[model samples]
Target: MKLALFLVLLTLSMSTRAVLDDCTCLVDCKCKKSLRPGQYYCASPDVDTDSQAIRNCNRDTGTVEVPCYAAPNVSCGGLPYNATQCIFTESRPCTFVNGKRYNYYLAVGLSLFLGMLGVDRFYLGYPAIGLMKLCTMGFFLIGHLLDFLLILLQVVGPADQTGYYAPFYGPLVSRVLVNGTDPFIESSSSCTL
Candidate 1:
């Protein structure tokens, strides 16, 4: 019975005399000196903020106050953080794709002079439609009128190899002299006999 009592007392004394070697157990970690926004702090509580002005008054911890943020006191700039706000900035979901440029003059000329021949359709890139139109002569000219309206509205866009309109160019009369292709082939060539 006496030995049991002595061990209990001995344990209590050892715990009370334990070493407090580092600053870890040190409370009231208020900044000794003022620190700028980006500078580093060496002591237990590394960063100081305007919010920390009142010091640690955490009711749960009584008089001990802990720094609001972690060790690094990087420059986050003043109120209303623009950097974080930029993360939710405007987004352009739909983009306008400029299609291949089809020579406007050449396409228009083909539609006007040889609409029934489907030359315009051929120029724009629809070989099958051009052939059908050529064989039937634009359904006795009714389809020709429709094509003219479609062309004006940009519905009959120049075809790319992918068959999509992308940045079509209207043929400049001056550029014709520069590139120089066979007039007959350009004007009247047909995929079929």
Candidate 2:
């Protein structure tokens, strides 16, 4: 029975791998063969080899790729695509602040638990505010609530004017406008005065 079950699992895994190997582009793009065997790119016909809008693919392995611009020092405004060219772009995620870093979850935890003692303020390097909170018991509890809200919303950050360390596993919010367009809108057909 164990051997039969193993064979069944093996068959399922091979079938899944086969399905993944048959991935294809959904857009009206053409395949441009690469020098590597079974590897190619899917891109618009109008785009040249120098263009950054190409999507790499492997026909043999069946891997879908995310298109990205490879230019150095180019900022994508936290989006997947370039703001100017509308082509996909990639950037490294940052968690540093002035050569140091503080964990986001740790800040939130400190604020939630020991905010009244001003430990959270001290951790964030705000010594003045920490002193005030320590003396007044978090400003009669009002300041503690306010600080908690500020920290939760990510409005208050490190003392160096840089951001806090990013969480390892959670949603990351980036307030970036792409192409000067409103992200709340679903369509761009509306006429403006």
Candidate 3:
């Protein structure tokens, strides 16, 4: 039948020119082809050239790698890239040192509703334990329930220690244990009697 419709329109124009030559666009803005093959859709005039931003096509230096909010000094842990909304996140939420960040849900909502007026130890600056928990009112309440469980288990931070500020959602409380793996899982097999 006419040579099988000319070999099915030359195999659909050679697989649509090899999917438009592997979705070209080496980044100069306005590419747009991504249906999820190699991913391609530029328009990043530093994150708002009309906001397309999908970026991922450097199949051997084809280029497209500048959008961590334009790179330079790229911060997330110390939080600065215009205070983050995510151009690319590894998840850091807070770390600021001298400038101080402090605000894990406003120190657990001022240690759970004003913490017997110690005001969460003066909002975590610890002004002499917030004047001794406002002259023992909170202390009489057992230091306002142990300072609301040590500021909700963040273990009472911020007297310029610079920690809390994480709550984009809730419940973080890390206290460091990264890459951990040796808690006595029992593997001592070496008896050479």
Candidate 4:
């Protein structure tokens, strides 16, 4: 009788234990594929390259349907949230859509330090332009200046094999920098494949 009573108590105690599974899907927008249809991946201001959008695959449609941007504020209370707070500054891992990504800092560094050598173009897979810049000293230095401006303007990001521009600092890297960790890694000895 005592053994059975002890077993019952053990089972009851185990069941009573609290399990916290607070999956904040809306507070932080992230893209994730869902097996079930009608599960929409909604991102505020439209989905961008980065995965900073709500990934709640089960948000009900109609009156109960909550938007990624609107969910956080309404859930947090009646107070309005700052627009900047919604921004996330973490870069998505590479291999995101055919391994297309470029380092923003590297392009800027090359533009500043090696534009005359056309190293930036070479790095960006523009071998012809790189060669021209190399031979003509960055198009007699005019192209070099223009290239620098373009790089800062985000007009000169590396292209994927498909020739689509792959910018390093996109929606993914728009998060607030905390403790020096962001999309563009600064202090890594080896590159992430």
- What is the TM-score of candidate 2? 0.44
TM-score ranking, best first: 2, 4, 1, 3
Off by over 4 Å in 3: 1-94, 99-123, 132-134, 155-193
In candidate 1, what residue range of length 10 has the lowest lDDT sum?
Answer: 86-95
Task: Score every model by TM-score.
Answer: 0.34, 0.44, 0.26, 0.38
Return the lDDT, model 2, position 18: 32
Regarding TM-score, does 2 or 3 come out ahead? 2
User: Residue 162 CA error for candidate 3 (Å)?
Assistant: 4.6
lDDT on C-alpha atoms for all candidate structures: 0.43, 0.51, 0.48, 0.47
Q: Candidate 2: which stretches are off by over 4 Å? A: 1-98, 176-193
Encode model 4's per-residue lDDT on 1-193: one tens digit a residue: 6576455544433332221122133333232111112122122222234532322212121011222222222222232533222211122223222234355667778988899889999988799999999999989989999999887776666655322223433432323447855544344312233
User: lDDT score of model 2?
Assistant: 0.51
Clashes (N, CA, C under 3 Å) per candidate? 18, 1, 0, 7
Better-scoring candidate (TM-score), 1 or 2: 2
Model 1 misplacement above 4 A: 1-100, 161-193
**lDDT score at residue 10, model 2, on the 0-100 scale:** 49
